[model samples]
Target chain A: MSQVLVVTSGKGGVGKTTTTAALGAAIAVTGQTVVVVDFDVGLRNLDLVMGAERRVVYDLINVVQGIAKLPQALIRDKRIDTLSLLPASQTRDKDALTDDGVARVIKELRAKFDWVICDSPAGIERGATLAMRYADAAIIVTNPEVSSVRDSDRIVGLLDSKTKKAELGERIEKHILITRFDAARAARGEMLNIKDVLDILSLPLLGIIPESEEVLRASNLGTPVTLNDPTSAPARAYCDAACRLLGQDLPMVIPNDRKSIFEKLLGRRAA
Target chain B: MSVLGLFRLRGTAPVARERLHILLSHERSNRGRPDLLAILRDEILAVVAKHVSVDHDQVHVTMDRGQIVSRLEINVELQHPANGPIAAEREKAAMTIVHQASR
Candidate 1:
């Protein structure tokens, strides 16, 4: 059975697109056919992140507006044959994405793809709502901060009340993926701990992607961190999250910022 | 500061949880479930008043959210009119109306 999952966070700059690309790539690596749809109209970046920016000619708007067919707009990744990218139009306005058009495209995508991962734009506007309109499950990307957590809560409320399943009285599956988590800072009481976020959001923890420069490097290189450096901390965490999405019972391991024994000994001696 | 005070440094976590809980509760009340308790109380009172005399303030309606099913508690006091088991009949009638209204 195919499933549509939306990676959404009400606040911007919380790594929703990054999470979508990583998870989509990781899942595709497991031999599952996956397509990541960029739902951020007018500010299309999924194609760039997927390294398919130059390859995108006809986009989601073209398909929705009947200017191009679904197959014509779909960009299949050469690196991973099973993975595809449905890029959004960078020049089109957000109003171009109509409800009926989105429903048609999503229905078609679900017929061919095993996992349709929609990367939602920041905010609770028409674009974001349409992205999540047909989702069977939601991965809420949140940072370990007050404003991010608060906005995530609002999105959770909307998911419970606004989604198609919600309107039909069926519960929509929700998971929390905390992005840019700095364990060292949290240990030093500078940032909120994992437990603090969980307490506020009250959703099952999918995975914690640690704050790392590798994520930026991977994006700049036009490759998802999972495909670029699978051994990196963020990549491993995202892979683990993808496994969890497939119903695997994996223990969440929060990566620690490595400190040498010499530093530990020096601190102890000073104490 | 005392050593205990160091451990008890108030964080924004608890505050966030409290604020979210209050906000969500208000939203649910406004959009989801209506004031069913008040309506049930009025309906039960109207049903019981026909059988036996009762005060307007005699009916009490409360809701307790439990682990399994949320329980709705209703209480009604009946004034005896030279009592010939009229209180019991009125109670049964009120209970029937309440059960029907709930469904």
Candidate 2:
């Protein structure tokens, strides 16, 4: 069955778009036909991040409103033929995304694509809800911080109550994808660490992406970190996350950026 | 352990983690569930405190629903104080809270 996955974090700037783009592209690289749908209307950036901004002719809002067909709005990845993007409208707000309209678009995409990944907007509003409405599973993108983790917990409650599967008494699979983790800082007790995040949310771990400059550069260059720097720390983490999602029983590799030879052995001592 | 690590005060992470843990649990308990969970935990601690000096961190009150039954389970680590009217007071409290229905 084609799985619809929503990449969501209730808090903004926690890398929902980045994860959506990165995970989608990585999955596509593995030969699966993936369509990443941007649900963050009025603040669309999936196109820009996925390097399809120039190619975005018709967007998700257009498809939802019947202004354009699903194929017309979907922007295919130039590099990865298996990857495509359904960009969100920049001028129109989420009010244009009616429930029935979104359901039709999602249903059509489901029949054609192997993976329909929705990039949800921040907050518990209409856009966020509709993004996860038809999802078979969810990737709760969370940062290792108090506000992000707490917001993720809020998202979790919504996933259990507000989603289609939840409404039908069916369980929706949820995975916690922790991003921008700074192990050194975590050890110093500067903010919530991996263990703290896992304990607080109590969800199954997906992958831990280390805080790295390449992630920002990829966003700026309109490329996913996985494609931009696949061998880099964060990119590797995303790839691992993708593989794990593919049911590959891969061991979890917590991305640690600290490379100091002395501190490496000490492991949180210098931190 | 590094000598400096041993001397260093617990960092902000623990404080943040503890706060988030309490906040999320309380928030979660409010959705289709009683809002009294947070209050109940505190009240239980207060009632228990009148007799035994219990550490606030040592108590855990949680709700769990199995296939057949949903229960509010309370787990507490009893601190055996050096000296006090512990046994009689505990028995009296237990009778009032748990055994009162029979009476």
**C-alpha lDDT of all candidate models, in order:** 0.85, 0.85
Point out where model 1 deviates above 4 Å: A256-271, B1-103
True contacts kept of 1: 0.13
Backbone clash pairs for candidate 2 read: none
Clashes of each: 0, 0
In model 2, the Cα lDDT at residue A130 comes to: 97
TM-score of chain A of 2: 0.94
Give the C-alpha interface root-mean-square deviation per candidate. Answer: 3.4, 1.0
Please provide, for model 2 over B1-103, each residue's C-alpha lDDT reduced to its tens digit, 9 standing for 90 to 100: 7999778768878888887876766567566665444456577768888877766576666664322333555666665555453533322222112211111
Per-residue lDDT of model 2, residues A137-209, tens digit only: 9999998888999899999999999998999999999999999888778877886888888888888999999
Top candidate, metric DockQ: 2
Worst 10 residues of 2 chain A by lDDT: A262-271
List model 1 lDDT by residue over A1-271, tens digit each. 9999999999999999899999999999999999999999999999999999999989999999999999999999989999999999999888999999999999999999999999999999989998999999999999988788878988998888878889899999999999999887777666788897897678999999999887899999999989987877888899999999988999999753344698686764211
TM-score per candidate, chains pooled: 0.73, 0.77
Residue A153 of model 2: what lDDT? 91
Model 2 lDDT, residue A209, Cα = 92
**Candidate with the greatest TM-score versus the true structure:** 2
